[model samples]
Target: MTTTSGFLLDQVMVTRGETRLLDTITAHLPGGHCTAVVGPSGAGKSTLLRLLNRLDDPSSGRILLDGIPITELDVLDLRRRVGLVAQQPVLLTDRVAEDLRVGRSELGDHGIRELLQRVGLPVEFVQRRTSELSGGEAQRVCLARALAVEPEVLLLDEPTSALDGVSSGVIVEAARDHVAAGGTVVLVSHDLAVVRGIADTVLVLDHGHLIAHGHPDEIDYLEAGR
Candidate 1:
């Protein structure tokens, strides 16, 4: 693993033309904690999360993992340690089992089944076609795929949006379980209730700037809006 410590952004900024997508963001997401980034659309929550795993680079400043600049690490190795589950789940192969083996080509059926079980999927799901899965089922499959690599950190964007209670609950528990097992999770969401349940620290953003960050109970999320 490239890092055991969580992410740190130092005076980071992202600019396009005259606009700043993220401005001077500075935060420490410690290992073994769930940190939620929340705000209305265009708040730069996703922008900031994307920077952690090198999906996008900052115009200025740095991002570090385990006290080393992310730019200094091999991008592929970094991604393996810090897995990302995007807003939409995309299966690489038609079958669910093959999709989980993207970063882990040598993973056997036993390992694949364990990953599915970790995400609350049935063993039978291994042979199912991704196209036949429901929204919730697909998301679970994505989660299992991300977990297949045994990532130290998970970056989730809008993880539980528009899902049934059972699926949402499973996703929530997965984040919690990851933290419980000494891993870190950085989650971006519009749902305050979900954030309240999982976030050990909450970051409120507005128009590319970090407005507030602290424990869930300390932040005034009402003013921030979804």
Candidate 2:
């Protein structure tokens, strides 16, 4: 493993088309801590996470990971360390197992089985078709796929948004366990209940600008909603 880690956003700006999404913002996401970004629709919460992982280039300023500027690193290498999971989970392979092994060439059935169990998938899922999985099952598989590489920073864009209570709980539990085992998790969620239980630190953003930065309980979310 290379000595590559840590993320710092210094006066960063984000834009899509002519719309200025995120204004110049500076923030530090400590390594190995789970930071829940809470905000309503149109807030730049997701955009912030996207900028950190270099999924989208910033309009201005700089993003540094482990003291190295993001622009200077190889695109593929940068994404490998900063894993991103979207709201609508996408499985890239025909089979569930193939999805997990996409970035990890060294992973085998045994390794896949272990990850499956960790994410609450049955062993039967290894040989099952990706299309056959349920909504929650697919999300778990996506989480498993992300964890297979053991990324330093995990970007989850409401990974549980589409699942039922049982599935949501499973995914959340797995994520908590992953961070407990020493992975940095950055999540964006409008669900205050979910953020309250999991977020060690919470940052609230509004209209592409960070409005409140603190624990969810400390700040009245109702006040932030206005």
Best by lDDT: 1
In model 2, pairs of residues that clash are: 6-66
Predict model 2's lDDT versus the native.
0.82
Q: Clash number for model 2?
A: 1
Q: lDDT tens string, model 2, 1-226?
A: 1334457778888877888898887777766777888777888888888887777888999988887898999989888988988777899999988999999978999999999988878888999999998877887888899899988878888887877777677777877886888888888887666677777777777788877776656767634454
Candidate 1 TM-score, true structure as reference: 0.94
Task: Give the Cα lDDT of each candidate.
Answer: 0.88, 0.82
Tens-digit lDDT string for candidate 1 (13-94) = 9999999999999888888899999888999988888898899999999999989999999999999999998888777799
The TM-score values for the models, in the order shown, are: 0.94, 0.91
Give the number of the best model, judged by TM-score: 1
- Candidate 2: RMSD to truth: 2.9
Candidate 1 regions with alpha-carbon error over 4 angstroms: 1-4, 222-226
